[model samples]
Target chain A: DAGITQSPRHKVTETGTPVTLRCHQTENHRYMYWYRQDPGHGLRLIHYSYGVKDTDKGEVSDGYSVSRSKTEDFLLTLESATSSQTSVYFCATSITSYNEQFFGPGTRLTVL
Target chain B: AQTVTQSQPEMSVQEAETVTLSCTYDTSESDYYLFWYKQPPSRQMILVIRQEAYKQQNATENRFSVNFQKAAKSFSLKISDSQLGDAAMYFCAYVNFGNEKLTFGTGTRLTIIP
Candidate 1:
């Protein structure tokens, strides 16, 4: 919610295929994050961007890459998605490090 | 490294009853933030409550309140007058000062019985 939108809410893709998930925010939050949710793992951060063209890896950055071309859009790309990458992905935005981060509706990606 | 732990994997509470979900964290930093997020069947992550490490007073929102024991390094969520809508998986998360990245715990699945 909170003016955050994630595209392709549900997608079923084949193994080794490239996939990109988009997150757009109108709130102009200064920070954006990409995370994945698995059954046993609550939510693991894949990557984050503090400003346009400024990105950094997170705890689970392997097999995933991110880019922030504008203040409103953050993209997550899986070069070659594997079955292990199948999970629900969430995008969150925060105005600052101390502010409450707002989350967008999650995107469920299934790799076959 | 900071880690959050939710010991209870599953819990059930009858309608109109109270339920408490426990969460604890391990962190060396004194200044940080704690949060509880709820994910229902719809798969939307909702912020239920939050507590700041420096604040001594517990944070309360409607029927949702938190028991924050900073000395004990514990933060637990209490929900009163539970309803069917309260059935969801709750996650406890932590973030250190100056860092927006969050570390989350394995969730606790809550079931509401009529």
Candidate 2:
């Protein structure tokens, strides 16, 4: 569990609405990442934060924005939810070099 | 950009048998690292094994091991005496030197038949 928790384990929202997924970690790790998992595509990096207010876009950054205002909290927002954005979101924390990544249980989002 | 490839979309092995999941990556860095992660139906990503690009010896963790070929840019995971617990989607990952981000493969769904 690594003291990581994700809010709204499952969500059902209508299209064109705004949605935000929260990831909170007690480990106070320096690195936090947001990834989306799809059936054939596997896991695609959405965004990541190296530190507070320091973040970078990943391979599939479109329609996704992230914020790391605090060391333990990282937020992912989908400005306008769409059906295409429906996927299982996972938050992972690591110390260094991706040797071991602690992932939250995961959040399944559905856009109706 | 580094890319990890898991060519086997699906594989199956009988109980107590051995199975190998193939994974290949493209990276120019000399000091990168490779990893194998397993995601069961529970959806929790668990680390299975890891290999350092600088080390020549294969990494073994319990019944899980990795065959790492640095020159061929290939790192494969082998499971001996496969058990039903080994049934899951296995992902191969790569991390470049000095970078903490990991790139993952599409994953190979491994099934352990009774």
Candidate 3:
């Protein structure tokens, strides 16, 4: 798991609700990323952070928001969870952009 | 944008045999990196191997080796002496130099038969 931990390994929530997933790392890597994995589609980046308070959108950023207030913590929030947002989420960290990334075990979210 | 393609949706191999999974990528940049990640039934993404575009030598780790064709824009992973534990979903990924985003392929599911 590379010193990374994601809270709420499994969660079931109703649609139109709010859900937030937390990613914490001990490696103190400068780059952190949040990705979602679904059937037929590989892991798709939802958001990433370069440094504390520095965040950027990824390919599938809709209905998702991210916040990074600390180097070791990156949070992904779904303001209004929808059925389409139900998927397994993974968090990854890297010392540098060009270096290999270390992934967390992953968090599975289900929206009904 | 860089894109990775894994042509094989599923593959199977006999125990102690070998299998090769195909992957092709499209990238305009000359400086980049390619990686193979394994996701077993546990759904944990594990780094199988990596290859730098600048390196001519293929990267290898124990039973895992890659056939990298820089000119052909192809990178394939070969697993020798296949074991049941090796059965998993393999994903090919690409990352450009100085970029933080990783583009991944759909993945190839591998099954090892005893």
Candidate 4:
């Protein structure tokens, strides 16, 4: 665990409900990323932000959206949560994309 | 597209004994980075070791070291003096230069036997 922190470490929600996860970092890194971990799938990137207000899609960005209003905060929103979206989400930060990333303790989301 | 493969689904080693986890990757890029990450029951992703494609010397971090064969596209992790705390899920990852997104393998669960 680095200086990053994720909110609502554990949550249980229902399908079709909206959910938002927050990632905060004190390292002031230039890059931040959102990823989901599930069985048989180690970790899949959902989205990433290169700089404040600059964001891009990742390999599995569908059904997910991200916002970076500041360097320390990156938000991942599920407009309509689905059972398939239930998984452990992790947030990572790095000085650059090519550099090693520091991950936070993950947030576990469960959709019923 | 870059891909990482961890052939071992589960591995067990006696306490104080050593074990090796195999990882192979496929990539067309010449410059990239390879990493071994450990996830304990706590589910925290910890960096075990990392290797730069341009570096010929193997990377070592304490009791954890990597055998990197650029030609064979193989990067394996060797853990020495196994401890109970070492038991965890190990993941192999690859990241190509110019693109920071990491591609990960399915992961191998390591069990330390007393």
Best by DockQ: 3
List TM-scores for all candidates, in order. 0.97, 0.98, 0.98, 0.98
Candidate 2 backbone collisions, by pair: none
Worst 10 residues of 4 chain A by lDDT: A94-103
User: Candidate 1 at A22: error in angstroms?
Assistant: 0.5
Deviating ranges (above 4 Å) for candidate 4: none
Better of 1 and 4 by lDDT: 4
Superposition error at B71 for model 1 (Å): 1.4
lDDT by residue (tens digit), candidate 2, A74-97: 999999999999999999998764
Query: Which candidate do you rate higher for DockQ, 1 or 2?
Result: 1
User: Model 1 segments beyond 4 Å from truth?
Assistant: none
Shift of residue A27 alpha carbon in model 2, Å: 1.1
* Deviation (Å) of B109 in candidate 4: 0.4
Candidate 1 - CAPRI tier?
Answer: medium
Question: Rank order by lDDT, top first?
Answer: 3, 4, 1, 2
TM-score of 1: 0.97
Clashes of 2: 0
Cα lDDT tens digits, model 3, A32-89, are 9999999879999999999999999999999999999999899999999999999999
State the displacement of the C-alpha of residue A56, model 3, in Å, after optimal TM-score superposition.
0.7
Per-residue CA lDDT of candidate 4, range B1-114, in tens?
888999999999999999999999999999999999999999988888889999999999999999999999999999999999999999999998899688889999999999
- RMSD in Å for all candidates: 1.0, 0.9, 0.8, 0.9
